[model samples]
Target: MISMDEFIEFVRGGPLGPIKKWGTKWSLWPVHLVTACCGAELAHAFACGYDGERIGALNYGIARQTNLIIVEGAITRKMAKVLRITWEQMPDPKFVIVMGACGLQGGIFWNGYHMVKPSDVVPVDFFIPGCPPTPEALLRGIRQLQFKIETGEAKTSATFPEVPLEAGRKPRVLPKSPKKISKAPAVIVNAPKEVDWEFGQKLVEEIKAKVEAKSVTITGKNRIAVKVESDYIPRAAMRLREMGFDHVKNVNVIDVPNEDKFIVEYHFSSYSVKELMPVIVNVFADIPRENPRVKSLASMFPSADYMEREMHDFFGVIFEGNPWMGRKFLLAPDAPEFPLRKDFKLEEEVYVR
Candidate 1:
């Protein structure tokens, strides 16, 4: 079997060169690899309103059958591997068109630890610049790629004049550090003032009667904050379950490096009881940051399973009894561990002309 480059050369050198180029140009099938928000623009380009098929290019499903890969937006470090794998699976003579500013040099996520340039991962044929490139811009990129295939020469659709900087005016530089993690940021997780809600007050009283809470306060109209010792979280969760707080809405971990502790909170709500639907109960505790481990409430609230895994991924908090503990759930296998922690700093980016 001839290689992709050999086949391309054969077609170009043969008498049917024009025909082969024409056919290939018109039948560009882009595999679906929507990586971020820019995918919305790509969708708009191919949707009924834009009718991208009018140019003979159609969005295909399988990478094996497609000839083009349209990278929709921000390609993170995790997604770069997927992009490379998908590109390798395609047949020879494959093309790539990257859309969005994120694909070029990281765009808004320039300082993000996870952001990766699409060009660094694949041989790009064209780049459409936009936070989320417009549908028209994406289609234009397709047209440019088609022109390159037929003419055997690459051409940009548009060009702009170079702006000159004033003499002795140095280019602005990004700070070496991107984030300023506070050494001792004041964390007011359950600082309660006052709220005039009879039902909330009654609910707080009822919770105090059942659970051994450190403090129970009505933080808002339908919200109650319950402070508890890390060891008593399971008991608090059990009491809340009995009170009809059927599900866990969110599980969060706030890292306080100065205090050497992690503030873990589980926001619970109810769908079984009508009156409790709007009420959100926050059960929280501070655990030692060095060995942040909490008893998993998954046994009581099945809905907390995924949220627990997410918290475990971000803060490296061990949610004991959760089956996915010590394993990556939401992050890529190669992603940095505990990236969301306050001390994990992103690499500084320097722009070059």
Candidate 2:
């Protein structure tokens, strides 16, 4: 749309030209869009040993000042929105570097319903693949980005091509689920493992006697899984509390869509009891997916309060006694409903006044 002189000036980066390229390449400040375990690896790159200041890519908190975005680790549905918003805020001549196996293909969260690829969210210049990529490797990615900035060598698969859209199709259509969805492997957390922990036997026996659970098995060295009925979660929590398992370390909800159930688990561990401090007891229960309701253990284990609200928001799992139920907690008010569920489909919600 511009004249020949204008086009030449644009290609030459206005007046500064090579000086601009040189400045941009060296002074590539990064704004982090990090999540999960890969955040630690990103921190190590900026830590005492590696020295990120020397690399000339010091992390900035705000988006406008930074030219680079280091998207570290798994990008969820919610995080994808944040990534786009942050990327849009940057001034000009921006670059994206996704650093982790999770950012590319989900890694440990391999078939997760909520997982969103970093490349799908933004134009990624480099992808450093590892469970968590090393500091040296991340440094190399930054250097490559710098190289691309200065030299304009657009490597194959490094950046996205601006594809012309088809006439009838809308961008960012959600993928259709397979006609027949298979049930996930039932034995994830409670898979019985025979470890040489003699103490586990007595501990399991004690827990079994106290809590009327369907199955009580040692999953790992110091890990015991106690699965009770949905109605019996409160009773089981109280019984575990009486037996020195004082607090809830973690509360999780696993969606088993094909089975028409949701597995709710509370990882109970002891702080006051020194002997039991090393051990972790995972008490879990299954709930009907259609009518997901269970007794909340927030009163019994205060730590379960926030997680219960989070689960409610993500999967629409109602914890009957939790006061914070029937409201948004972790997710935005406009976010897709029960997004973590396996059969989640994107649908437009309309309101009539």
> Which candidate wins on TM-score?
1
lDDT of 2: 0.86
Give Cα distance to truth, residue 222, candidate 1, Å: 0.9
Model 1: lDDT equals 0.90
Candidate 2, residue 172: the lDDT equals 71
For model 1, what is the error of residue 313's alpha carbon versus the real structure, in angstroms, after optimal superposition?
0.9
* Model 1 vs. true fold: TM: 0.85
Superposed on all Cα atoms, model 2 deviates from the true structure by an RMSD in Å of: 10.0
- Residue pairs in clash, model 1: none
Q: Which stretches of candidate 2 lie over 4 Å from their true place?
A: 1-64, 67-77, 80-201, 214-221, 256-259, 332-334, 345-353
Expressed as tens digits, the lDDT of each residue in 49-90 for candidate 1 is 999999989999999999999998789988999999999999
* Residue-level lDDT tens digits of model 2 in 270-303: 9999989999999999899899999998987789
Q: lDDT at 142 for candidate 1?
A: 95
